[model samples]
Target: MDTVYSVVGLGKLGASMAAAIASRGFRVIGVDINRRAVEAVNAGQAPVQETGLEELIAANQKRLRATLDHHEAVLNSDVTFVVVPTPSDERGAFSLQYAAWAFRKIGYALKEKKGYHLVVLTSTVLPGSTRYGLLPILEKESGKRCGVDFGLCYSPEFIALGSVIRDFLNPDFTLIGEYDEKSGSLLESTYARILENNAPCYRMSFENAELAKIAVNTFVTMKITFANMLADLCERIPGGNIDAVTQALGADQRIGPKYLKGSLGYGGPCFPRDNIALSFFARAVDTAAELAETTDRINRALPAKIVEQLKPFFHKGATVAVLGLAYKPFSHVVEESQGIYLAKTLADIGFRVVGYDPLAAEPARIELRDQAVVLDSLEECLNQAEVVIIATPDPVFRRLTLADLQDRNVETVVDCWRILEKELKGHSIRYITIGQNINDEESQARLIKLWGNTDANSDT
Candidate 1:
């Protein structure tokens, strides 16, 4: 049998990594503390939904299997990828317990094994954490000098939730922060086919790689904050559309368009936590990131602003339809998502909220069971809703027409992504949206009267 590479967690990222490595003609054994998670992968069932995960799992089933025993997985493999979870604490510090727990166990497993193996830390950690926390433990437990008896490196995984399989097989770039070139070469060889495509390879020291992940997220968060600021300004102007302004701005060569559209501030398992963690890391060095701190405040306040707008629309005991509940477009993940926070706030304020998402319905239901009613069909949820709030811009939701919403009891539509703007116009239905003009005749008149017409055209 050929030597195998082991993935020490069977979550979405870990499972996808195992399947991807196995598909490349290598043996892969997945390990997870959750027996059910392990069993699902071994039986060709993916624990999480992704674009092409099932096919990948089936194609590599023979070469891939799962187990709960870390020792067995470690002893049987030549290379190990530690892709465990590293969530944030209540005070926003990066909690290392989960990553530390897995690393400590891996260290014990390495103690009993005899071979020159490579272990790559694929989880996000604060700068200098791997060198300070993980390296010393592994060296202590194994009673062997690192880089001599074994090799270690940090090659962080950067996969989007719904498109993980594709991201893994064809990454935009690969960041390898190795202790030495020889160790990096071994890790790079494992991804030789991937590297052959000429994707950018970033070679750096361990701390820089850690900060790079945080820096990327911080930059994206800043972009989102800037977009949201424009959205707020656009709402105040009479005829200004923030989306249109930003679209034009994006056309400029200097500002090439991507994360420029304003919507609910970023939230998922990654961005918010990473942003806060980066800020905390900066504070430790007696240097504070004022911009990152501002971005986080802006993001947190966005959901509240959404709730405030909906409050005036709600009559006593009114029902509201919340569309697309996931944090982002297609993923089922709701961690730190604005949609979930909005649902909770709406429900607490006495509005009955019904949420619908293409893939996130079930997960959202479990996550928000006490906060709102998660529905399977959009049509049913909108039946008696006084307001329809499209929280997520799921491509499927964009296909909805005014006719479909006409049959519902919806008196107003809140378009978070500026979606269905033309369709809502044709129906002449009262609609309110972030980053766009209000369509309700009465609301428009009131806004004009209160604010007075200043420059409606602010696209210069």
Candidate 2:
């Protein structure tokens, strides 16, 4: 714990990492090019929005500080973690533009410092990015041999935006892509002392670790898409329930039941892009990645497809309310959200859309502009709607009762996650769930005809 840590790029992940590290009895220096971020962190406040981030930063004030100078941070710390953005390019590959710049600055700082310092890249990137794209920049700017003078590592954090601090302190495992044995050992030991969970460490070469990081994300998305595909199939079958099917699938030892909700398509800043990036990476090295490509295609088309299916339920120019506009529950981020996509698609089809989220109303309003009305309160959104679509499985929507929904003016409710099935099933309002049959008798007759059954009592 005596070794000071410096976290570069004070965005959501970086800022949370700095605060979380400091909370565990280590001095942390936060580095960012943004003056506001630096000033905010230095004043014991969080620069970006995240769950419990402001309070965590405020609590760890004594051990944490921020600086704009990379030289100051690197010279004073034993290990510097670079968490700059590697945004997706037009080719769907993670662009190393920001990461390269950060490495160059850290490399320059290494030239002036005399001891062994470990530089860890905690940003997500494609395979060979750390070794090929970023490693040379570090060696060139420092004018030094990598393992001999200093050590380097590519150690991306597997975390989501909302629960970053909690996820960081208690990760299932830590990945270390080492320049040499010395570097990996240092990072592993650092995790041992700092992490609250005492997680296992996976150590390997830079390329393998980089590929593994992206592979984990892409694979999870594939699993999620498979569940969604089943959801689509379930809608056609008589009395098919996605929850029952997924529960059985989850009991299987291989599947293990996470991200198998089978309601909405996977969407977020990371999930939507990682699959495309992995597909792009696979094709670059003479490999076919149809699963990833297909997953991306299916997930992208899900919003519009759902909208089209609900077209019959919607009346022309009917006021519609979309509850939960954020990507997932308990976060303000609207980037690549299915809720936002649903709002736009619904509005484009002539529905007067009003959207609401506990935290994401402002950003959703900005993204939606004139397409939908982003309301200040959920009550206001519900009060103005003739029809409602539950886009996210937020807990507030889950708590809605039959009386809360049945004003006699609201005609229909489409529950995407079946959150209101028990409360509104036998009510005056027409209730529909996304992954279940609306007309069971009609579906049974269609299935009977397909099997050439002449009698209604005959079994296929």
Best by TM-score: 2
What TM-score does model 2 achieve against the real structure? 0.97
Please state every model's RMSD to the true fold in angstroms: 4.0, 2.1
The CA lDDT of each predicted structure is 0.83, 0.92
Candidate 2 clash pair list: none
Residue 269 in candidate 2, Cα distance off native in Å = 0.9
lDDT of 1 by residue, 234-344 (tens): 776667688788989889998767789987899888888777887888888899988889899889988888788657766777888888788988787888888888888
User: Deviation in angstroms for 139 in model 2?
Assistant: 0.7
* Model 2 C-alpha lDDT versus the unseen true structure: 0.92
The per-residue C-alpha lDDT of model 2 at residue 272 equals 91
How many Å off is the CA of 160 in candidate 1?
1.1
